[model samples]
Target chain A: MNLKIALLGGDGVGPEVLAQAVKCLQSVEVTFNHHFTFSPALVGATAIDQTGNPLPDETLEICKNSNAVLFGAIGDPKYDNDPIAKVRPEQGLLKLRKELGLFSNIRPVRVYPSLIDRSPLKKEIISGVDFTIYRELTGGIYFGEKKLNEKGTVASDLCEYSEKEISRMAHLAFKAAKNRRKKVTLIDKANVLETSRLWRKVVTRIGESYPEIELDFLFVDNAAMQMILNPAQFDVILTNNMFGDIISDEASVITGSIGLLASASVGTDFAMFEPIHGSYPQATGLDIANPIAAILSAAMLIEHHGLNEEAQAIYMAVENAIINNVVTSDLNPDSRFGTDYVGNYIANSIVDTD
Target chain B: MNLKIALLGGDGVGPEVLAQAVKCLQSVEVTFNHHFTFSPALVGATAIDQTGNPLPDETLEICKNSNAVLFGAIGDPKYDNDPIAKVRPEQGLLKLRKELGLFSNIRPVRVYPSLIDRSPLKKEIISGVDFTIYRELTGGIYFGEKKLNEKGTVASDLCEYSEKEISRMAHLAFKAAKNRRKKVTLIDKANVLETSRLWRKVVTRIGESYPEIELDFLFVDNAAMQMILNPAQFDVILTNNMFGDIISDEASVITGSIGLLASASVGTDFAMFEPIHGSYPQATGLDIANPIAAILSAAMLIEHHGLNEEAQAIYMAVENAIINNVVTSDLNPDSRFGTDYVGNYIANSIVDTD
Candidate 1:
């Protein structure tokens, strides 16, 4: 099969990481009898610098034409340090999500035995933790109308959500649960938030349609505790965009590093796979940034493409590489970094040895 | 100085826990030569069964007349199973908060040395984890418009916040930072929610008032990770209701048991103190529910009243009791029990030791 993949190497170490992702794709292609066409695009601070638009027309076109988009990372300290910058790096990424109608951000947390000790959680606590979180990508207060009223001393943000938005995500969450351990935990603040009450009522009504799966509604507070306490009990956690972003990152460390987690934003006709970690501008060009997250995101892309065998192959190779100590300084900061060198190593393992 | 304290030992193991709290108050009174009158009232499921109103007129009158209120656990599984029930136990608590205009909930998370191992987090990660969370109460989506759509297939809730609502909380948070570590992390989802952006902008404006205090904004997601990775980095975490609830509970277990935390909900004219743990209906009448949280809330109440000596005395007694292995089963479940017995032991220690 021939696949056209959109490559979005946003800002910071994004380019360095994408180079490694390309190598992984090359290795996968060589071994799997498949062909991949790579098209590069910009969507972060770098894009703003070049085209004056973080997510420019050329970039969107590339992504629209591709079977899937592989995002590296975004943001820059320049924009981060300067709070008043009108055109920011994050805007591009958020725009892409909304434009593409990417409604669910899927973040999977799985502890690798080799790095369990690195987790802040005790071994017993984090040992068997494995779960996937589906965060609503485009709705809730993030996309709401924001304003500064009465000479800027006063500010307000209107958070409004339609039932259609809730229905679409609920469908995805329900589908994911059907594939997982047959349990779905909808995390919301229904007890307090009107939005959450709406969430509960919608999800609960939809829940009746799926009796085979156990549906549980948790106030976000309890969900946060349960995430760290008994992570094994969870299969798929469905929540709003904000809840997902926070919980996913919190759940990220349960596995290892924020730099080691990957997420896929799925829409009606487009899918964007990216490492959930932000652009570490400090680490740009330092080859020490962990590429495993990007590499794993590629693995997710493969699986999403219905190439489970190829996806499983990449996962196995990546897992083996970690077990064998072919890692970057981000994972083991004490060691010297072969940043892209680690990706090359994993790619080599996938093709040479496997 | 004399104070009127209204005590409501609601339902389940509520009365037993209140007994211990009363004892601790008496102990503090003796140590500081401070006298306070205690008037007990009924609330929660207990009140519902007796008077058909979770927050009875008598209970409200007592709480309103008193200088402060001490609340034990509430809820009954009977109500939990019946989601459609018009009268429920939690309603009383929520009503108390709304009626009294308890606008800020302060949950203090302190890692007890002896129980550090009880946490799912590594001892090193949690040993020095001390932070206080202030959640915006009586506002946000809790009071927003909730509607079930025409098809009954969609449910939606609205989350709204004005600048004025957030300003008061921001002032309190910045002031807290100045008093403690001079650093405050505001947890919100500015990236996604307009409400969150409103939070950030208002807090940022209020922060100008406290130039000496270092203030930073964190997306709720990143804050969640930082909470586990570097909890000591946080002194005062201020956020809206839902986010605070999630993060606070998440912070609770990192210190120890959910049964080992206390909180205070304060407004202009009134305050309510309660253990962070929910009413463990299963443990009701078993005399095994830990009362330290309730006891600790009393300590907080004393501190609020400027009875520092009395507060410190109660705290030392609770700590010393824990040190001496005189705790309820929740703390050391294997051998600890007779929740009443644990309360009595702590109360006795409060008197005999000092």
Candidate 2:
């Protein structure tokens, strides 16, 4: 099989960590006897520095031509602090998502037994905790109409949703639930917000099509509490863009290592995989940032392409690395392994296992 | 001093637990030699059942005439499950906040040493966690204009903020911080939403007047993660309505006992106190509900009236009850104490201490 993958190592530690994922993917190519072509493009702060646009036309064209896009991280400290900055690094990523029509963001959170003690939660609370979040990425307040009055005394942002938007994500969540614990908890503010009521109505209708899936509801505020008090109660959480952003990030920390979470964003025709962690500007060029999330993202990309066995190989290698204590400082502070060392170790493990 | 207080025990365990708070207040009245008048009013689902209105005219009138209001819980599963119902128990509380101009909702979260083991988080993470959340109550998406398309295919909710709205809450949060830890963290989505930028701009300007206090900012998503990762790092959290609702609820569970948390809603001319926990319909008549939160709310009411010593008396008594293990089943599952029993114990302790 031949696969074309777009690689966007946006900024900061994104480039270093993504390099490790590429190395592991190359190892997979040799071990599995598959042909793969990698196309590199500039995006985010680095792209803005060079082309004066976060998502240059060339970058979008490269991504449009690829089978799947593997994204590292984006954002820079310089752009984050400036509220009035016209061209921001995040806008580049947001524009890419809109252009690609990526509407669903899938993030799976799981607790590894070996690292259970590292979590801030009690062992009893975090043990056996595994859940996935289905977030609507293309719509809601982030893409809604925003306005600032002439006097600048008042500002507003619209949070709008259509049945088409809600239904597409609902179908994805229900399909995923069928393969998991067969439950989907839709989190929204239905009692107060009109959009939430729409979400409940459409999702309820969609649930009828999937008779095997058990659908439930939770107010976003209550869901936030439940996430801390009892995260294991959830199987798949579906929510709007803003609530999803907050809930998924909240869910990410429960595993004790934000460095190990990977996410995939999918639309009708395009999909992008990336680590949930930010660019980590402080760790830029240090070669100390964790590469596991990026490597896992590569595995997800492979799985997206219908290569189940190859994806499982990557997962097995990652799990083996964790069990053997071949991890970066984020997981085991005493470990002396850097990003490249851990990446090389995982790549080697994959080849040796084969 | 003479005081007029409106008491609204709306639904479920609201009336039962609120009775305990009233009992503690009565004990304070007798011990402090003050005259207090209690006016009973109907609100929430119970009011809807009797009068077909959640917030009746008489109820609003009673609240307007009172100096301060002591509220119980609201909402019922019967109303909560029905999405199309025109009347909701929550609407009463939202209307009351708007009518009374209660712009700020204050919730303080602290970890009690005696109940520290009950927390889901590790002891080290929640040991000295102490912070207050100042939430803008009567603005943002909850009170914004909501629209549903004629075909019901699309829905939108506006999240608007004015300089006036942001500054008023900012002043209260800054003033509160002046008395506690001299730091205020403003959480918003300035990186994406326009209203958030306005929040940052207004709050930054307000921080200039309070030179002695430190002001910081966090994106709402990052703030959600930080709340779980290191809650102790926060001193006072100031945020808009929706984020506040989620963050405060999330912060409540870190202390292990949501039943022990209390909140206050205040305006220029009036104030209201209530427990942060909701009406537990399951435990309504069983007397198994915890009353500490209600009792603590009564303490806040006294403090609002400038009776600090009187408030301290209630706090000391409540602490004495917890220290003596005279708590409800929620606090100590093995203990057989009921709501009335714990309330009586705390009231008796308040009198005995005087």
Per-residue lDDT of candidate 2, residues B61-163 (tens digit): 9999998999999999999999899999988998898899999999989888899999999999998999999999889999899999999999999999999
Candidate 2: list runs displaced more than 4 Å: A45-56, A75-91, A351-354, B45-56, B76-92, B351-354
Give TM per candidate.
Answer: 0.93, 0.93
Report every candidate's CA lDDT.
0.83, 0.93
Going through the candidates in order, the fraction of native interface contacts each one reproduces equals 0.68, 0.98
lDDT string for model 1 (A1-354, tens) is 799999999998888887887888888898988999999988899999999998999999999999999999998888888978999998899889877878888988888898888888888878877788999977776666566665554444545566778877888888888877989899987765667777787788888898888998887878788778888888989998777777777888775566778889999899999997778888888778888889999989988888777777778888887888888876776666487678888888774333
- On a 0 to 1 TM-score scale, where does candidate 1 land against the true structure? 0.93
Q: For all candidates listed, what's the TM-score of chain B alone?
A: 0.93, 0.93
**Candidate 2, position A92, lDDT:** 91
As for model 1, its CA RMSD to the true structure in angstroms is 2.7
True contacts kept of 2: 0.98
The list of candidate 1 runs beyond 4 A from truth reads A82-84, A151-155, A192-194, A197-212, A334-337, A351-354, B148-156, B174-179, B191-194, B197-213, B334-337, B351-354
| CA displacement after TM-score superposition, residue A253 of candidate 1 (Å) | 2.1
Candidate 1 chain A TM is 0.93
Model 2: how far is A276 from its true place, Å?
2.1
In angstroms, the error of model 2 at A24 is: 2.4
